[model samples]
Target: MALRRITQETFDAAVRENVDEFEMDPDEALREAVEQFQSQGVDLSCIVKAVPAATSDDKHQEQTHEILQALESLSVAQDSPDSTKAAADIKCFTEQCLLGFAQRYLAAQKGAYPVILSYCQKSMGEREATFAALSALSALTDGQPDLLDADGKRFLLDALEQHQDDSSVTRAAISAVRHACLKHEQNRQDLVKAGALPLLTSAVKRHSGCAEVVKEASAALRIMTFDDDVRVTFGHAHEHAKMIVLQHNGLKVLIDSAKAHNDNITVLSELCATLSRLAVRNEFCQDICDLGGLKLMMTLLAGSYESAELVRQVLSAIRAVAGNDDVKDAVVKAGGVQLIVIAMNRHMIISAVCEQGCACLSVLALRKPNNCKVIMEEGGALAAVQAMKSHPGVVNVQKQACMLLRNLVSHQPNYSQPILEMGVEALILQALRAHRDCGDAAKAALRDLGCQVELRELWTGKRGGITN
Candidate 1:
């Protein structure tokens, strides 16, 4: 075959045609064009000059310069005779520029966060400017609280307090604070020390109509609970983070937000996960049950079969609420055991779902003897046994499975024959052999089934009283 000599114009034309006609992404089109030329034995190295890609620091500097120019123009525009028109123009321009910086968090990392936060602090009195600045701050400071100094933190808290009536500003402020404290312990502590809990909770109530505000406020409260000090203070030693939120009627807002945005998977997932975390504390279990948390969790579980993450969250929440006697009864009455089994069977491949499912069942079984009956009637014991067999690699699931089985056999001796018939003893013995960490529980479970001889033989010559 004769060689086809490809010129620069030809290559450019091919790229353009591929991008326009085939609707291919520009980068992909370029790559394909280059490959086509190379396959024809065309030398690309000599024709294609490679320009160095801009470093994150360099891009950040360029963005900073652009933002500074916009800010300067905005300052000058505010003083013009046509101040209203100029201010609007400046606000529009500044918002776009700030949004660009915020979207590229790497750009903010190179010392642009303080500059953006300064704009937020300075523009607090101007609604439009304040909204743009706060929005930018929210995006830029996410998980990077060190970007904001003490003054910036205080300003953010104040913004949440001072703009309670301004829905846009309040939402932005709450989101910004949420981002700031999401993973930063010091920032959470700072907010707590500054007494931000009441301000945030108040935002939830004051802006109940604004779903965005409620969502952001709930998110901020959720992130704040990650801090040990804040958790203890807000939840106390016995109470949960939800109790503090309940005091501010934040639970109603969260529930209402989930109801209103039922189709919004992200919103619902976050709300469910937050509720799960709060439900884990013993003090708030009944409160959550009284507030209809169990029904909500069951509903989520029923509808969330396609999303393992949502299923896991719902199961985890149920597990937490299962700690309460009334809640355990409520869960069984609400067909929660069936839902747990469904979650386990559907997402059995996912270790987290299995762990949470087994853990929830274990909690229910240990607390309520009647729950053992419901579990066996619902085939929950078989599900637990199956989970142990399927996820032998998941030590936590194995341990939880062992616990659930032990609960079933110990609490209701009448169910022992049924459980043993499920071949749970073999699964436990396998777990004992597979995961040494699971040996104690597994051995105990075998003993609970009146298999002391096997347990003795299994542990005869092994270190820690178990054979390998």
Candidate 2:
């Protein structure tokens, strides 16, 4: 059964009661509160679960926290005449924000979002102040998506459009957009409605040499292609991706940027992810090939053999574009299959890299008998077997490895004898028994590899229905 959930305020009240009324120590009171709520089958994962240190004087009792105090000071400085003091105060708050997202979360719960937003609104004309406030706002809203309420979204888009001439401000504002729309679907649509797509792409072009700007803009573009919202019944992921690619020359822009920053692993990783997201159409896949994306990915794959994250992203990009048949031919012609096997060999212990590598090989082998010969000759079968054994508990690794096994023999059943010699039968059987999500994949793999499966019967002229 699911545990019942209580709000943060309720838990805080209970803790406070135990401390102030019962006169218990703060630590003991917090533990007692947690025990009391959890005894009633309550979920406490979302609760902060920490006590704020207290100080008292004759005039005041239980004063505000460090974050709350800093917010109050920044609030007062917003009206002060001394620009230097105001900058210093805001700077202090920005330093506080740099501590971590927990401090930022506590600040937002204490109403810091609106205060800092108002500061941003008032600091527009002053370049230094505007940059500082935007930085603080971006930090404050990092993981606190609730603070984006309509006004916060408007300000982020406005900041993007208003501050294009300044790379620092543009980077900061793009950072805020990347954070604001991360899991918030409405914020994504609203910003795109107000013209954020072109501005983001243009920023990448205007500041291609600025690694920080390119990185942030690339991340923002990728975040815009997410379908991660749980609040809405439907998301605009496909629509947003199409708008970015078809209307904004996203393929050209992203590929060109990737070319410029080939040596920068961070930027290259982000561009690889963005390229994967843009492969939503058949022609889009062909476009990626036509724009030299396939060759670029091949180069990155061979060059970044030691970078686990970059190699994983590169494999994913290859998988995405291989949805096109011609592109698959091109990848195989470019020795993509053998490079994938080498990547799996290099990062065999890393499950993510191995999983993507196997999945990419599976795509390359689909419906192409010649590719299967290359996979077998290049030890792709041995690599898949090792990935399954290394990460037995990882369902994705198991499932993709199973599919790769199946694709390797799908069009060429004569190759099954060699794969079976590698002892993949027991592993496939294990996956079939372990994960229900991958049962069909494992079954298809076994069947295509010329293994016997317990066939089910459903047609004996049953009167009303087929067998269940």
Candidate 3:
């Protein structure tokens, strides 16, 4: 008989009798039928509807579970060349079954998180199983917010926590949480509070040379620490906070990672930013200083022209740590003053990084007047002013220049008189030509410089009507 015209009565019997069929032999006839549909390029929704409703018999239930399990496996293997043909065939069959069950299928069955998590932990040697569970979680999380409740959340957390010190399991578990955290803010907060930071820190320390593990651990912490609510949660985890500080080797490891593997800029940049956040706070500045973070940051900033983002982040990390005079003195002593000026225009290569570098330079100037002198001597001030004029095609860079202007004037008020003397008013006024937040920043900086005749004339030449 042609598969297309299978009688509704036969399909109904299949559904009713094989209520547990999915868990059983996986209904080869059903599998073949779906394969035919796939081969013919037909949608299987109608065909899926033809399957009968599941029977209530216990034996049938077992069979149905098996079928579902098989379907899940097939769903995951669809990409494998060896399994593609069979997997595609099974997808069509499972689609029909899933279509028949509809939302009821999803609703009637428990979400696959527990099963998926279990498979991932035990199947480390089996890349396919680990991949399959990872793929399954993507679909399950897509639909079910309440799928994994508090108990389920706790279970995954505890299981992952147990493997916190194990890099492979840590990587997988962190990957799993990356999705879970998005499902609910509370889940993210719970993970942070449950000692994830320390575990991640430990993993970073132990597996310092393992690029992938460090990347994953850093990524997990990024998601957890990104939101303000999660930050507060991190704050409450005082012991973990201390652990992050005491794990003094993390900064050096990250610095070494970036230096040793230039290809992993993305990973290394994230690690730098993550550590900056954790250790940049006032309480942790001393730890950062003791660990030689200032010198490492200066090296990155001075040398990393290829990765503007990493350099910018390293600079920000320095700012976070440099709030202390000793740290700032260390930074100045390490020649950070000379580097910040060159970074302003040259490393302004990326708009975001340029913005961050600009801010970092401003902070450095505020801390060390001699650094401000380096900025001026290197024409860093002029470069900043021109960056404002050329405007880098990114609003953030313009804003950073304007911010740098504000910092320069505020930190070196007397020295900035020469900048005004050199006709920088026109440049600042040019940035203000655009009526936006950046323009506002430019205008505010100029206004703060007070009134000077050269500055007034420069503004007038640019058709900037300044009333002072």
Candidate 4:
């Protein structure tokens, strides 16, 4: 006798009858039905689609019931004398169910967090179970962080402190912390205050070889160091938040991670972005350069990265570090000028990249004869001029371009003729008339160009229009 193939209608009818009429355990019934269908070589996706959607309240109650049941099963397994294997099995099952429930009914999953928290607290000794509980907590917190009450937050931090040697548990805890503080400034502050930062730093240092742990730890650190207020709070009088990162050897771990996972663009991008943000404070710029960040940035710019964000970050870091005259000379000596100009020409349409590129060139040209000469010689001036022309509508690009030109003309008058021959003066004048935000800088550049008469006439027309 041939076996009967289970159609979508047949599977749905079975699930409905078991769930509604017999009041069978929904989780058990669903699992058995799936296994039976798999043994029969029936496609299950169609059956999933055919299942009827529940009303909002029904859906919430359904998710709540499943979560509570999973927690109960985990609690029972934990109580067994030979609980390790059984607990692992139960935790895996619970995690899978919670993942599905969270995805479908995230808001409704809050009611089960207390049970989830208790499971985490109880399963602290069971590594697999603790990891599973933390994973679910991370997912739930990620979808709705408001569900993570103070007790839950403290439990996560306590888990991090206790699991310093356990890579799996530490990674999951870090993931939970990362999600909890993703965009919530208050949560980030709370984590920092709870000593989460040092724990995260230790996680990165200890799990140097574990990519997931390092990724999550670095991501959490990135968030903690992101807020300017947090930086100010953690930093000393004259120092910035980046100093906290540096104190923990965060930069070293970030650089090491980038080197180890050279192919992982997400890790590198986040690392570079965090580094860039840290470099924004002038006090930390030289520190970044001293740590060999300048060399790494040039190498990244030299390589082929498909992420424009990474390039933007590299340029922003370079711009920040170049503010220091010594680092500016270092950048110019390391062939950074040419690479920056190349990035500018390549991503001309990206206003942030263009703005940072021009800002870097402007800073590099600041009273530094070697840097200025390099900019003019390496076609940096042309890149800036072209950026201004191509993206006149971008206010910051125009502002930075005008400032770069002013610096070039003021510090390196020898390049004035070449820059003029490139028709930068025309573009500068156009910027003056087009963007009020850039008029002051544009007027200054024109005056430097010995076009005082044109500047006066343009100002006169503006005054005449205002008077009328």
Candidate 5:
């Protein structure tokens, strides 16, 4: 027979029964409870398998955990006066347990998730308490995403839809939804199907002025674009990304949201990164340009010269949108190459900035000969060589720099000597030798730079090499 599941409260009560009624030793009581549960096929993986603490009034035992006490306090009926206090208690406990690496996980194991989720469902009529309960669920579900099952997903979506006018409630609930869908694929699909896309885009539109809401909603929107689910051979990442753009007017909403957050570097960085994710389509890339995305990104890049994180994201946005040929021309015409080189030079120590900067240059100089000249004129090639020199140990930086070099001279061979003068040939060779992944990119750069390279032939036109 399959073992039936029991709540932690039930198991804890059983253990307490053995200890108190039979006057058994605490260890013996716990052993008996474990044996009894396992004999009946109870899965103990989610169980804490420990004794409950005595009340604080009984000084003989240590005080129970604040988190546990809060959970217990929330399990009872909260009248008019007690509801506010209950909200405060859960909110405090959630904040207190937020920093621990595994406190929330243990809390969930102790039935904290259901308790908090139930409170959230019941307290929806009361905004403050609902926010607190939703906040608790968010904190608990952060690392333990599996706790967010179908019921939780449904509740979150309903809460988000119902609380559309309440930014705080929407923020807390969306924060929960973000944490739940983060690395869990089924949750992402279910939430999106349960109408997460429209709710999320609307949240961004409605709460554009609220930094916290916009930030969380931005993050949640980006999560919807993830293809992190490995079980499915073919992912819906591109489809979902396109949906967010076309079906939801995501580009205009995000662009408008970004404009309001120009002075806020963190929000700007997040929004910029999200825009890059949504730029999965050619026309979407064009739409980004149509929405003044390039102009906004260049403006942010120019002002954020000292902020490495923001500069890197801005470069990422620029790189993503430059997929369209016209956008590439616009980026170059906007002096994007000069700003990117300046950002790369300013933050050479940051491998991410260097990597993104090289990637941006590579994308801009892809097919446009004039853009390649602009890149060279603005020291784009030299910046790439310096990035390779600065972060040779980092394979991605090396790879992108190699790619940028390849693009620089792919169409305009005249720019090859100036690039070769930067001593990038040895650097390319070093990266090619040091990293297995950089082999193709580095060799292409070497070949295009008018250098001799060994090109391997996978198969010879011989009987032994013939599959037929």
Candidate 6:
């Protein structure tokens, strides 16, 4: 009966007969009808509806999950019984039920991503089942500020310690940690103290698991391991990076993975960005330069319109190794300036990627005066000028680009004169007109240009700087 689909009247008659007492096949009639409908490419929603919901919430959840799985299996099947419409219907129904239950269940649990972290271990065995639950759970916890509980918080760290073998579980566990970390600084410290950082760094290096899982772990690690104690925890991660820095093929794998998977983009970008951070350390820079990481990063930027995040990450990773004069010269020799300019031009066309691109340009402009010339000439200055004008709505991007200009204009006061001469001062003046956060950077940049306009003039153009 559980294995087949049946009709309303026939299935009702079967249920009434106590058919098992007579050893009757309860779903025999329904199964045949389902198979026939499938063979004719018909939707099976009517037949699927015949299966009764389980008696309790727990059983209902399981049955609902099973229904979702059945739909996925059929949809992906080489010989799907129904038309494409059936698959779409199944996906829609499953997503609605699954997301609805997950949200309500999680809201009931009140910020316990780790509860499903444990429950799914027992309840979910298949890959999609685990991911489905994790994805839904992520949505539930995403912006709910009041959801944290002490017990739920502890479960995340405990799961990391106990379940390192299952990357899937570890991934979800760390995502919970990341949510916690973002919610409170103490939770961030707790993650580092509970050995979460080591486990996450290990998972990121593996890079062979589900991309989403690996990236989430890396992201959690990136968020949690920035301060001093957590930085010490990353010592082992740093050592491991050193070993791989010299291995060309392994470094290539990280870059290629960063470029290919959209799911892996954030974490992979984080890894590269983190590696760039590590590369800022003298010992690590030596290892990266020896491994040819800078050249590979430069190569990544040559082909334009690739993933903006990946390009930004690669540029950041390169700056990690290119800290010294020799490394900077080598990067220039390797066409790094052209690629950076290309990223800058694309920055205007793309969003989000601009942050890192501007970050990379700032890194380069601070070190190389001639590179600033390349940037300003390649319309890098114009792009920054335009960004300063267009992106007052996004504060961080404006801050970074304006700061980059301050750095570039300072680096080559003579060369960047054209940028200043191009009415950039006026644009910065206009960008500072908003009272939002981006306005602060715009005023600072204006000050950098020797225009002693008060903050009030930039924000409200009043006669005086407003003091609270």
lDDT at residue 88 of model 6 (Cα atoms): 51
Q: Name model 4 segments beyond 4 Å from true.
A: 1-52, 55-116, 143-147, 228-246, 280-283, 305-307, 425-468
Ranking by TM-score: 2, 5, 1, 4, 3, 6
Report the error of model 2 at residue 421, Å.
Answer: 1.4
What is the clash count for each candidate, in the order shown? 0, 0, 20, 0, 1, 3
- 109-227, model 3: which lDDT tens digit per residue? 54344544454345445444444444444344433434545654554565455555556655655666665665355666566666556666666666766787778767666555444
lDDT of 4 by residue, 433-454 (tens): 7889987888887777666534
| Best-matching candidate per lDDT | 2
Estimated TM-score for each candidate: 0.70, 0.90, 0.63, 0.68, 0.85, 0.56
Tens digits of per-residue lDDT for model 5, 178-258: 889877777888888889999999999998999999999888889888877666676677888988988999999999999
Error of 4 at 232 (Å): 12
lDDT of each: 0.72, 0.87, 0.58, 0.72, 0.86, 0.56
Q: Report the Cα lDDT for residue 241, model 1.
A: 66
Q: Evaluate residue 189 in candidate 3 and report its C-alpha lDDT on the 0 to 100 scale.
A: 59
lDDT of 6 at 275: 58
Q: Kindly give the stretch of ten consecutive residues in candidate 6 with the minimal lDDT sum.
A: 102-111
Model 2 regions more than 4 Å off: 1-61, 455-468
Q: On residues 312-420, what C-alpha lDDT tens digit does candidate 2 reach at each position?
A: 9999999999999889999989999889999999999999999999999999889889888988899999999999999999999999999999998988999899899
How many clashes in candidate 2?
A: 0
Which candidate number has the best TM-score? Answer: 2
Return the TM-score for candidate 4, rounded to 2 decimals: 0.68
Q: What does the lDDT read for residue 225 in candidate 2?
A: 89
